[model samples]
Target: MVTAPFNWRPHSRGRIADDGHGSAVGPQQAVDVEAARAARRRLVIDRSCRVPCLVLFCSAVVWLLAGTLLAMIASFKLHEPRFLADFAPLTFGRIRPAHLNVVAYGWAFNAALASLLWIKCRLAATPLRGGALVLAGAGLWNVGVLLGTLAILTGRGHSTAWLEFPVPAAAMLYGGFALVAIAAVLSLAARRVRRLYVSQWYLLGALLWFPWCFTVAFILLMPAPVGGVTESAIGGWYTRNLIGLWFSAVGVAIIYYLLPKLTGRPLYSHQLALLGFWALAVCYPWTGMRHLIAGPLPAWAITVSIAASVMLLIPLLAVTLNFHKTIRGRYRLVGPSPTLRFIVFAAVCYLLVGGQGVLLALRSVNEVFSLTHTIIGHAHLGMYGFFTMAMFGAMYYIIPRLTGREWASVGLIRIHFWCVGLGLALMVGVLTAGGIIQGLELNRAAAPLGHYIDEHGLSEGVGAFLSQLQVRGGAVDFLDVTRGTIPWLELRTLSGMMLLAGHIAFAVLVGLNVAGHSPPRPGPMLLSAAGRGRPLE
Candidate 1:
């Protein structure tokens, strides 16, 4: 078992009666010294990671903006298919997957890798190892994403959900990820702090879990293709694991680190954190197959998946309680600290989304929501509502330290938060409500169609079947179902625009901060007017 570092000490401000030099150090003086040493150590770590982290972050922002545009296009096309009908590359089919790949691999992965590097270095109390390798990896990874996105747009992309990237692009991503993984491992091995923080456990798990999932998915789907229902099962497994095991792991790690650091509170319980981590690791892999509920998969497989999804509540509650107790009386800090605000919001989303996921995994719920906009909304709630928000908070905290400058405008930060928050809420709400309507209509339509297929046998053509479906009383028409969702799709497009606005504001803020448009901050840049001049910790 790992042991705590000998030098680890609780934050204290007690006076020392005597020093080894035969002098007395007052309480305030001792506190200042300790703070200074901590600051210096953080500076060294940040400086060591500055170039690579900045590169990764900047690339992430670019991809974020690009993906946001793609999302807007795709969202608009859903309600108005003829909007970009003339352009083959701008079709909904291509744009949607391109947006997904760009956001997932381009924005999310880069930001996550940057966070991993900096957080690992700080947790280990060591300067980043293999910074050059990390930089090179960033280059390769971004290029791969760009190539993959282009391939998707140009119609050469695969139909796989997350692995839409071509083989060459996937290979590049794997190589680049391997290089950074090596750096992360090296940093961990060279850690000055022998005891690992809770964040370290999660970061390391994410770093390891992603590669295993990605490689296995790649091998099964690409080099030696699986057939029939097995392919769909594997795809579902990969998609679920990518979100639950990989992205959520990194998101949770950031939350665990940022909450206590920003709030100046010790974690409520170390035991809770451990319990949450292990519970998540053990349960999330099995939970992926729940996505295949009501599909061709076996009853036992779906049953096992649903059970594992329910088990996720263990970690979900553990994390929620740990965070809630840690910030029990420090709610005031959430107003003043951008990092705290975004992270706290994300922490809450984690609970909501986790619970929703369990509900979705149930066969009864899955039957209604399957293949509807509801699933799309849920995915966004997890990806953007939780993971992206956490990443935003992390970048807000890390960017200032790297650039020695604070965010340029508090107004823009507020705009970013509200736009994203309101937009996502609206989007998810409408899609869910609309999806239920659509699902009910489709389910109603299915009965007559199934009856016709049963009576007419396989010889009846689609034309005859559809003609018969039209005359059947009480049968909901497919066009009516499509029309019913149009308004919700329109609202979703509007929400996408709002989200795009927020992303643009964020991009501009990052630009100003990195370009040193704002005066150098004396300490962390808190969001509140009163706290602007105050130093954190």
Candidate 2:
């Protein structure tokens, strides 16, 4: 059985170390020496990662704030369009896509890259190599995201969902990612550890999968655009894979690593982890076509996607069980450790999102929910609730170690957590419930209107016929359907405000820590009142 390299335990206290003069050293002393060596090695690796990781993290935080502002603007405009209607750049169309691209590429990508670099180096037991190249990549990536976001606001964005960035911006992003990918490969090749962990497998898979998906989507959708339903199919495929294969893979990898490390426990089952990985690998790629269901796509394609999505339950169950068991006895640690709490929350979101995905993929459910606020709520639950939360947890754990400092304020952390958590839950709940009502209303209105039009015909003046149909109670107005959703949209705006406040608190905390306002402490910062100065055992 392979043991975790991070969790060190002395095999036998009976074993003694020999001193230079042939005097025997105590086993406890020998264990301490080994533990010290491990600590020193970890410190070296952390120091090697410090500069690039900090750069990536700082950039991510800036983008996060920008995205949050954009999100708030867009959310408010949904219910009160006149609030920002005067500015063309701040129109709902522009601000919505701008918010999506900025957060996904700017904030999430940068944070994920930083986590990948730091975690990969530690797991490999190697110092980072090609730091200059990584820094260059970070610079180019941020520049690309900046230009892309500006282009979106200025109405230069593409029609594609996730690939809204223009061709030039996409090219720059591709180039920037290539450099980071090269550095990752080199780090992997130079590893001191022979055995690969489950987290390493996930990181490596994500690193490969993202570039392939991005390149294919770019080539087909940008330079030589596909026509008609094929275009929608390709876009749907790319968006689904980008979320599942890239963002989700990285998030799950971080969870696997942090759950064990923070709790100082071995993973409950390596076999289970491997099972989840392989299952996800097989299931996720095929599941993308489900997004194109009821469209002009082939029936078999949609069926296959639905099946794959259902099959995803296997991996979700495996991972959920493993994580739950690993952290079973350590529930108290969660309250104290911001990292554990965020990660644990993220894990629960993962389960909820995955299960939700399976249900959404079903034909009956998809027909009603598609193109509604329900889908929006579901997307945010996966992206913001699961992936973003995981990234936050990772930053909380990694930043302190890299900077050799603790978080400046636990209160700020608490505020960040509760506010974001509650806001997201509220946003998702209202949107989802409201979306169901909206969908039902729209569906009900459509059926009656279509029936009226078929029977009564357009022989009469078209406008007069519609007014007559409404009077006859044979049809419902589209405007009324839209009006029904307004209450939910207003609630969504309130949630956005809550989220903004949380993000500000988080930004302040990160800034304080990075600015060296927080003096270095001896033990890990815990939130518990009684364990303020207690060291990890």
lDDT against the true structure, each candidate: 0.83, 0.83
* TM-score between candidate 1 and the true structure: 0.90
lDDT of 2 by residue, 1-537 (tens): 223232332542111111011111222445565556667777888899899899999999999999999998998888888996998999999999999999999999999999999888877778888888899999999999999999999999999899999998999899999988888888888887666777899999999999998999899989999777888888888999999999999999999888866765556777888899999999999987887878888899899999999999999999999888877887787888888889999999999999999999999889878888999999999999999999999999899988988999888999999999999999999999888767655653333233444676755433343454334233246776677689899999899889889999999988988999887956688777754443232
Write the residue-wise lDDT of candidate 1 on 108-138 in tens digits: 9999999989888877877899999998899
RMSD (Cα, Å) for all candidates, in order, is 7.5, 7.6
lDDT of 1: 0.83
TM-score of each: 0.90, 0.90
